[model samples]
Target: MEKRQLTYKDAGVDIEAGETLVERIKPFAKRTFDSNVLAGIGGFGAGYLMPKGYREPVLVSGTDGVGTKLKVAQMANVHDTVGIDLVAMCVNDILTVGAKPLFFLDYFATGKLSVDVAADVVKGIAKGCEIAGCALIGGETAEMPDFYPEGEYDLAGFVVGVVEREDYVTGESISPGDVVLGLASSGIHSNGYSLVRKLFFEVLGLKVDDYVEELHSKVYEALLEPTRIYVKSVLKLLEEVPVKGMAHITGGGIPGNLVRVLPEGVDAVIEKGSWPFLPIFKFIQEKGNVPEEEMFKTFNMGIGYVVIVSPQHADRARQLLSEMGEKVFRIGEIVEGRGRVVLK
Candidate 1:
């Protein structure tokens, strides 16, 4: 009888592959570094120096994962964009409170580590941080044998931001007559993918590469459009406009998310048709035969983010956002009522 020696790689984990991925992604992460990033990738823990300015600085933090959207990316063999969706999901949430994103971190886990795919994903993450004006400080990559199937991985992100204590937009200031502005979404920005997949694949029998005239792109292209990052634009608008409240529309769509920001005495009255519904949404609604209310609840529809300001500041806010290259719409207004959202 003889015994055979086994190594980590034999167990489906490649230590060398992990190290190689670290090397490949270093340059990508470094590109997002700012002076405040005390230490970046390859460290046991990343370090960041808080910018010195606010009298009472408040640290805001958010964490999120790119829910089943990763499946779409994997099916399409598109690894890069979902990383942006991961960062956008977290950063946008913290931005709702007027926090300026300071840094980001990510978690990637899979059965077998493919250095090339992982690198592409990290590259996209760095790109997201650059767009967000934040440093990609550090992250973790785990190769768990048999945990995830081959060629499949999951992503999660964490972001830290800072805002002055008095400057935090708590939605408490959202009152009657405040205008609700809708910021155009970049088509199916990271939500409702479960239904999307069903409609396009199982029901419609569409392939990832199948092109549809209505969407003007392949199925995956429309479904995997990276979630829009509103940090820079919203942060800039906050400086010039008194944004009473802000909501990063995610899983629950506009009504579910926007209602969270309404004060006890006000309701958000969203006027339908005020904003252009992107073709993807229209296609999903018509193809899925999803009811109007269900569409608003499950998907962002068109608005990725919502900002509330006094009527006096609405026009100015819209102009500034538009000048910043955003498709801004005066979609609704706040009214006196119990805290809720009403679509008209």
Candidate 2:
């Protein structure tokens, strides 16, 4: 008997497959490139020229993952849109500070690399970058045997954006009378999926394709609706109006995320019925018997982003956002109190 030596391929790391993936994704990534992207894909590090227009440029950066929503994508055999969720999670966070996203990178890891599935995911990421108007400069794809089960992969996204120091929306200007406006979410927008899965799988035992009259679609479609990217509308608003503060609703929900930008001695009071509640949320609450408070603190509950503006600008802001095709809601207002979020 002879012992054979092992190569990296024998250990399940396919350098060739990664190289092929890089080739497949180049055109897609190139579509998202602007003049500032200094280099193309497959580089050791991405290069970007500092945008020339800002008088006092401040680089803003954020990183995030799709959370367990990736599991929903895996179960449904839907690999494309979670990449959008990945980009939305990070870019939306940077948008909170009024930054315009400049470039994006991603990390993909799996036990086995399926070229088709990986390509589909990266195409979605590139599409997301196009929608957000950012360049996809570089990414990492790792095939680690035993690290992830076959047909399963995890994704993470990183984004760098820039804003002038004078234009950063820090919420410091959020005064007692500032109005809180809510932007309707596209379905759940990628949070609270642990509970969502528990309700749909454990309690209700619903399959991805199972139809519910309430959702008016398959169970997985509603659950996997890609996270909404508010960058365009928010960026436009920042240019015309002085947004006192902005909050991108994510894992912690409206109250959880909104409080981060509130000034001391001020609280936000959200009206319960100010916005049209999406049916999926009602279905979840009724089926799971989830508490009302938990619902506000856990899910976007239809509101994906919030804008704080002075009373004079609230109506105009709502109008501008609506004209931009957003579903806007005048949901709340700031009040004098210890920094807190109040859902009335």
Candidate 3:
């Protein structure tokens, strides 16, 4: 017989590496497990049990990727926090509809798998799921050599949640003089990094490893800080009050996102200087001379989210959200218009 050799590595996928990673992450993933979880790591399908007595229970699902912000994570070699960003991006959208996130799954793809790095990513995901009261049921790890260059990978997440049909929130009741309440973001919540990378690395010659003016960590760390999942606090308030509308400020920032839930002929007028924006935004604007209009269109700037509510409910909403440690503000009011968001 002719000499023949067979190798798993030769086919460009690392089975052993994937196995080691699953082993490393198994313990951490189990930390977020609850009674409903039906499968462990490496399973083909994740399983969960829906709770009983949720009248007219509706399933709310959302999936999102980290966008080009992954470039900053790869540049900083910081894999841990981006995993939280991945989960938050998906889960937060579910919350906008007054849903409770029940379970989550992730997909990580890379050129060559590193057990330590992949575990770091999973640890953050587990931490997020824990905080959000959701089970980390299962995930996928793909190692492809040709598709992605070495040391580069992408992350995506899917979240499923439940909401009673009677309690679901939409801006159907939003009317003129309804208050626009702003919630401060921890930092940039995993959006608009395409221009950020260009401004810092390409235009200004700043390295991701270098510390900028006010930020204590590398530029990438400040930018790559994980997405904040607001499911817990917001869901708590939903149980007590009707949240007329909510906006998740992501790629299109305030103008595009806040207008998403506005009823026709209702407008949101936001005060430009109501909440303080983080220093990073100023740094990029000064360095790159990016226009104010483009910045608002592209980045979240200062506010991560805004809740549209009746003026009567604004004070109570702020009080409840403030009790949860969020800096809430009365940034604007609704007015008569045709699906418009005005920054005053």
TM-score (C-alpha, index-matched) for candidate 3: 0.97
* Cα misplacement distance, residue 94 of candidate 3 (Å): 0.9
TM, every model: 0.99, 0.98, 0.97
RMSD of 3: 1.3
Per-residue lDDT over 1-344 for candidate 1, one digit per residue giving the tens place of the 0 to 100 score: 69999999999989999999999999999999988888889989999998988899999999999989899889999998988998999999999999999999999999999999999999999999999999999999999999998899999999999999999999998888889999999988888989998998899999999989988888888888898999888988998989899999999999999998888988899999898899998898999999999999999988999999999998999999998889999999899999999999
Lowest lDDT sum, 10 consecutive residues, model 2, at 234-243
lDDT score at residue 148, model 3, on the 0-100 scale: 92
* Order of candidate numbers by lDDT, starting with the best: 1, 2, 3
Higher-TM-score candidate of 1 and 2: 1
Task: Record all residue pairs in model 2 with backbone atoms less than 3 Å apart, i.e. clashing.
Answer: none
Tens digit per residue, CA lDDT, model 3, 250-342: 999999999899999988899989888888787777778989988899888888877877878888898888888888878999999998999
* lDDT, model 2: 0.92
Screening candidate 3 with a backbone cut-off below 3 angstroms (N, C-alpha, C), the clashing residue pairs are none
Instruction: Kindly list the per-residue Cα lDDT of model 2 for residues 131-236, writing each as its tens digit.
Output: 8999999999989899998788999899999999988889988889889999999989888999999999999988988999888999988998998899899888
Candidate 3 — what's its lDDT? 0.85
